[model samples]
Target: MKWKVVVMLGAALTLFGCSKPDAEPTESELSNHQSQQVVIVHGLGRSAWSMQTMSDLISKQGYQVCVVDYPTLRQSIDNTLGESASAISNCLSQFEEADFVHTNQSKTHFVGHSLGGLVIRSYLANHPDFVSSKEMGEVVFLGTPNHGSDVADYFVNNGLLSLLGETATSLTTDPNSFPNSLPQPNYEFGVIAGTQSYPVFSGMFDNSNDGLVSVESTKLEGMKDFVEVDIKHDKLRRDPYVTRLILSFISTGTFDAS
Candidate 1:
């Protein structure tokens, strides 16, 4: 329940930040260097509203930020992927327009949380022409179950994952899933893992989890860098440490181990 509260608070803060007067200008307004846009995607059972904190913080760092939302539990994984791809494509088109109208550049970075991470990776893999590693500056995932989640297994075994349909299986147990489906590790990418465990759902996970995904499972072989922090799943996205790490990676193309 505390995790849910954290998510709600994050949503509220994001809304407040966006609505603030004197909202900062987009990347073009402040930079002569080519503008880099960051597209944020949220997790399952969540909305773009959930990623408000991330969007605000990254935007402050001077990247054009667009937070994407999709119906997580209402669509199949394939359908979700298609929808997510469309959203990303739309964002890219907007970036192209901004380039022609303002910065005159063409590129974007993508960051995703949980299931959103899966969707972004799936899109990049299947549509390499649109979002290749070169065009995609960096890919960052926060607490993604690149290996899959046992909690999802529990839900499916209990017949509770029916509402999620193929999305549940595609995300949870399928070997050909997002991170797994990526062709080659050609993009600059990083992975951040959480170590705090929520007591209410402790029984559902192995040790070293942020209530849902185990820290070890968040590790993927192809990532440029990997980091672990003491934050729960829901709070991890907004945690200053994680946010700072992501910013550092985006700017420097390396994770600050210090």
Candidate 2:
């Protein structure tokens, strides 16, 4: 599939009223002009490069950004969440002023795709003050299974496919399972669900799904905002529309409800 995210350097600036963009920052360029920090985490088995375009576009808004990558297939779900916590603190540590009392400290936002979203949620569960103490900002979940996933069950049921990952069972649809058992975000959060179904496993899900995750499963009890886009699960990181919504929530604490 040919996927292209059409975003310009000045797009974020124009929307945030920061300034005109000189040019697109190279993927390796690090900009720390703004006090706000946005950490981006890729989904299971995905690299930080998958989120590079969205991260670059967000940097145009004048915020420091860190794209996190971890070994999802190799680690247990619990271990991956530990990596998520480590990534968030490590990313925040890069900014000298990212502390609870600092002005910019309150704007530390986390954006994650798929299981990465669950990772953030799990992190917040352990350190619930991520928002209460104002140590962090809102979280944006892209195609996360806040409820749980059936695909995981399918894999766990098939011994042949179980070798794919050690964390698949943690994604079972039972609320008692890891995903649903996670505490809801104590801070402001927005969820974006994909409406397109992955035809292969869509039949397993009783509702509209994005192939791997169902739109219904993407919801939670306390997300501040929710929306659906006609995209796939893995594609959320690269979809221009999805990234724009992420920026909107990051800048304004709410997505375009309309």
Candidate 3:
């Protein structure tokens, strides 16, 4: 009963806004002349606003930040992935135009929450050239369901997943779902999972979860590192410690420092 209420409320919130891109800090002014760039993408049914906290934090650390805003409730995942790639490309191109010294040698890192992580994966999978051409750095996945999600499975089984658009359905645990079908990232990456479940609705999952994605669902075989936190799904990107973890992994390819 509690889980059903939560799902219904989530669906209601998702439908409250029009299918438009929200104004976001797409790229921080390149005042610091930082060569490294960090691109962040928000999760399902969320705007780039969802990643604002992390963006600000990373910006403070002197890295240029680009927040990709996609209409999660209105478009297909493939479209979102394409737009995200374009956004990153455009953001990086500016550095070259500015004639930043050694711009070609600068590292590009990615941070994604939930569906956003899959967008990064899909982009890399489809554009194999980016792996070598871009000189990509490490990636960080915050509560990303690399193995799909039970909540999505429940919605699919009840014929209600479509309410959140095709992206939600793609998160289902089905082996053939879009997310599940994507190949594991061949680059350096780390996974951060939240373990605090809603006690009243904990039974919804057989193991620990962050109200939406199970801890196990966030793991990938090639991840350079993995870390768990006592947080809920929505707050994973906002937590200060999680931000530190993200920064640590981005800098060292490990979350141990944070």
* Residue pairs in collision within model 3: none
lDDT of 1 by residue, 1-258 (tens): 556644533332232110122334455544732477888998877788878887877777677888887775657766777788888889888876784335334458788887777777777777767654445678898888777776666655655456546765555545765456655545678998878876655777756887777787777777888888778788876665677778767766776733
Q: What ranges in model 3 sit over 4 Å off? A: 1-33, 103-105
Q: How high a TM-score does candidate 3 get? A: 0.85
Which one is best on TM-score?
Answer: 3
The better-scoring model by lDDT among 2 and 3 is: 3
Higher-TM-score candidate of 1 and 3: 3
Candidate ranking under lDDT, highest first, comes to 3, 2, 1
lDDT of 2 by residue, 20-94 (tens): 233443443323236677888877667787788888778786677888877676567767777778877778677
RMSD of 2: 9.2
Choose 1 or 3, whichever is better by lDDT. 3
Top candidate when judged by lDDT against the true structure: 3
For residue 190, model 1's alpha carbon misses the true position, in angstroms, by 0.4
Using all chains and alpha carbons, the TM-scores for the candidates as numbered come to 0.80, 0.81, 0.85
In candidate 2, which residue pairs clash?
Answer: 198-211
